[model samples]
Target chain A: MTKTHYFYIGYGLLCLLGITSPLLNPWEGATTVWDRLYLKFYGVSPYGGFSLLSFLFYSIIYTGFLYQFQLFLTDYLSGRFYYTAIRYQSLARWFIHLGWQMSYKAACFLVVLATVTVLIGLALGDSPELTVSVLSNLTVIQLLIQFLLNGWLQLMNGLMIVFITAWVFKEPSYNLIAMGLLTIAALPVLNAGGWLPAGLNSTAYLSGQWEDLILITMKLVVYLLIQLVVIAVLFKRKNIAFY
Target chain B: MKLIEVVNVSKSFKGIQIFNQANAVFEQGNIYGILGPNGSGKSVLFKLICGFIKPDQGDIIIHPSYRSRRADFPQNFGIIIDRPGYAAGLTGFENLKRWAEIRNQIKDEDIKRTMRVVGLDPDARQKMKSYSLGMKQKIAFAQAIMENQQVLILDEPFNAMDVDSVKVLRELLIKYKQEGRTIILTSHNEEDIELLCDQVYQIRSHKLVPVNTMAKV
Candidate 1:
């Protein structure tokens, strides 16, 4: 297989693992109740939505994203009107690519985690969680490892995405590069503070970290935006049509 | 219909002019070979026709629609410029899968069948990085034929092929022409020029001047 093919396969496997991890943690009767319900003690449910149905639902959505990603890659590589083969590549952009798939899922993950945090908070008590969830109260602490590792995965992914886009489209603007850095940097900060919840943040933790996290998030988002605008300007100058 | 036409074409590199007012014509269903001395811009002419490189002064037009550029087209066309581009790190199967649907010319099953025709492994379980130069050439050929395009551009088909491989390709090109496909191939092998092409375009004096018959050993 080609490196890109392996990259697709390997990345799919990693993303599959990332997606399935939640399912394992939250599946009922699969783990001890101690493992199942504890956000502090266990972590983010072994899955999502409190059931296999939930996991299945998210899996379907993820598969759609994955499918679109594959299509985008196909079209990006060989499809050209000049060449005339496939449709436009949606996952063509770095921000849209990273932020679109995992980041969006990460966003939904935060919302789900938030919603679960509140419901569980009402059902269980404050500080009720799992051990894996509790490995670090600070996601930034995990950023060096877990979150950082996630960021690192995304960084490599983003880098690869940008590299390929530039290679195929033959246009890699400074904005794209700058935006990529900003996304990686800012995304981790949000993850650190709490935009897209991972690790284990109970309701109590979410509330307290809200303000500082928001600030960090704004800084990152604005930097990301500026980079995007710069990219937009570059695209405009070069007459790049994203269509 | 005029299959290919170049008008008022000019080329330059780093303030050096190599081609000026170069023009040529290619008719449909003809197997044309390009021949030239080194630095005669033979490959450059092929690229300009294949839409890889643009001439600074003039434009090339492919007839029936009179558009020469691939970027301006609405339908399918295929090309292999200079050297083939492939992801050497992927499996042959996986790599083909990446390009199997080029221009929507071939379906997935057709691609698989083509891969099989070229003796590529069904599963393409081997990475292209590990492929020998011979294997890589075969894969490149498979990719080109995978999509049944009307116009096929091959810069140098005999780059690393064995004699048998070359023979196979000659037969394959003849078969494709029988099916009425336009193939524009360039090679240093005079035999390739003689055996395959119906006509030959020689890059002499920085221009494509048609040789009456491209058949001579």
Candidate 2:
């Protein structure tokens, strides 16, 4: 099998483990691995702790990063797909060529993941009342909007990191690490300096008060513009043959 | 009429000069071969014509009908520079299909025919990662010729091919030229230069100079 097959298989197994672990052990597993990682690294978890909503939010963000990383690895191994796509001058095709479909599939996977976690969380009676209140307080419409907006923001962030790394290093692993370090370093400064709005300051945007919605939306727009500008500059200045 | 004109172009990378005040013209419906030692800027010259890279100090003018003054790539051209890259996860046919979608001028049958012409089996299921070097070269050739572009720029197009494949490609080049397509190629192989090209030039001292075809042959 090709390396791509292996990558998909590995990703499938990870999603399976993340989903099933909750059913097997209710108290710990339903909180998506990303939330756990965020808790470990940043000393903060989305929504103040683990909940069904936080799990879904973190899973979506994690999926974005994983999808971007897969694209990076694919480009590194093939050395032709991204370059050829750029030469054709179609941004949509370029995204499709680099596995943008996977990100959409990841969204579907998160839905399934959230449902399974909710079912298992209720069945196991692990803070069932808390899950109930969380589900009720956030209506389906609000939840859907949050999912779509937050997922887009995460995907944009992921793409920006990949584009910046491709511009500078053109290597996948190093780029991933560099992006990680840069984010970790930048977030604290952005947060402390009050450059970002309160709702945009942390992954806690999922539970942000309704009044902060406008601020969050504006932040998303600004991030999207930055992503487009970065991609345009990268394509315009960088030589295809060099990569 | 001139199909491409590179007027007083100069290029350098990281302070290393590749070409200095290089000027060359390619006429319509002729096969032009560039002969130079490795790193003599043969590929760079072809890239400039294709608009893959900008020259440090000159303008490359393609026929007005084909491209605008500031376009980065010519509108009707096929090119293979350095090693051809395709998606490793995609089958040979799929890679070509994706590229054909970008051009939107060729159908599936065209891609199949081009693959067959290049001696590649379009039905082959193996991804590009599993392809041998010769197979990769053939796939690259297939992509370049599939769209039936008016101009072709091929750098070292015959690399890693067997004798028979090379012969087939030479015939294909002749066929392309016969159809009034302007073809630009670079080669270190004197036999290739002699057998295929209508006019030959060698890069000497960072400039293109016409060589005696009779003397090279």
Candidate 3:
């Protein structure tokens, strides 16, 4: 197996032991799988002043995913990339292929996180039915689907932001801008709306109304499409010099 | 026939000129050598030839064959402008096999023969991370010639290679030239340039100056 496969296994173990273990323990207060998920996402909020430990735990996953992605992206910056890229008919096609790979990685990470959450929740005897205060209109299955879709979108947004930032600055090291953005977005503040870049990932910001959810989802999708165009433009002029 | 031409090409980085109205010609069935001091943009010229980077001014006219293939970069050209990289966890053979799978022009026996040509054990299971620098360079060389590319742009292709391996590669390059392949390389070793190059050029004052005609240009 590749190092990436091992990394996923390690990430799963870390989540099981560090994040979900304490949150889903039977000794914790009245909680269903929905409640556990709610608390988990609640810690992602900038305003609530929720569990600091929980927030840090989830942040590790986010940070780790970004770190892995950064490494993957930089691999193409090496000299060998030119040799491989020339084999392709067009550099744009190669860039698009890389985008698809990045999207696949984002989806895979969400699946890993979801699998770990479900395993922990089931083992601890938490009911799968929805019990969260927010998004009360949706059934358990719908809520879960929304959660996965939202999580995947947020990860894609983050990845694109990092990629665009690096390309704009013409420095691979500029990926730290994403880390800084995450730090500022995580700062405690009142009324942290879903409009905040990082807060969009928080379930606490999700409204009960399906209209709001759809609007937010559409907005994110549009924003991601625009970002894709911007990245392609930047890449068109980017010089692949890595001395 | 002229295979590649750099016509009045000018390039600069961060406002510092690397090349200014430079001109050079590479024809088929010849080994050309470029010599330059550190920071002289030897690699940049190779990158320009391979279409990895654009020249700021003037044109790099590749032969019609590349354009005929509809490839933005030069097709069927083997390049090693910088240190080659591969999956560090995979064996040398496996790494070459993975790269070969991209074009599917070469099979397992071809890969093994290339490895043997470069003085590597094709059956060895040693991962790339464990290979010495010389071994790694051989792997890079093996990959470059494995597909029988007609054009080769190599920068410091013999770096880190031992004497015997270097001699073997030098002979292989001559053999490639005999087979009507065009090869361009940069080397610090005077012997490599003396024994191999059909024509030699040196990077001087942001231009490629023909070594034998240095008094004129």
What is the TM-score of each predicted model, taking all chains together?
0.55, 0.79, 0.89
Off by over 4 Å in 1: A1-243, B38-40, B64-74, B101-108, B213-217
Residues A134-177 of candidate 2: C-alpha lDDT, one tens digit per residue? 32243334444544555455455555556566655655666657
lDDT of 3 at A204: 50
How many residue pairs clash (N, CA or C atoms closer than 3 angstroms) in each of the candidate models, in the order given?
Answer: 32, 0, 0
Local error of candidate 2 at residue A67 (angstroms):
6.4
lDDT tens per residue, model 1, B33-116: 877777777666755675545678897786645342323231235565445456655677666676554334457788778877
- For B1-217, candidate 2 gives per-residue lDDT tens digits of 8999988899887688988888888999999999888988887787677765678898788898777454456667777777778777789999999888876888999999999999999998998888999998888888888888778888889999999999999998998899899999987788998888888888888888878776866
Mark the regions of model 2 whose C-alpha exceeds 4 Å error after superposition: A18-140, A168-174, A182-190, A193-203, A234-238, B68-71, B214-217
lDDT of 3 at B128: 89
Residue B194 in candidate 1 has what lDDT? 80
True contacts kept of each: 0.00, 0.27, 0.53
Query: Candidates' lDDT values, in order?
Result: 0.52, 0.65, 0.75
Task: List the candidates ranked by lDDT, beginning with the highest.
Answer: 3, 2, 1
Lowest lDDT block of 10, candidate 2 chain B: B67-76
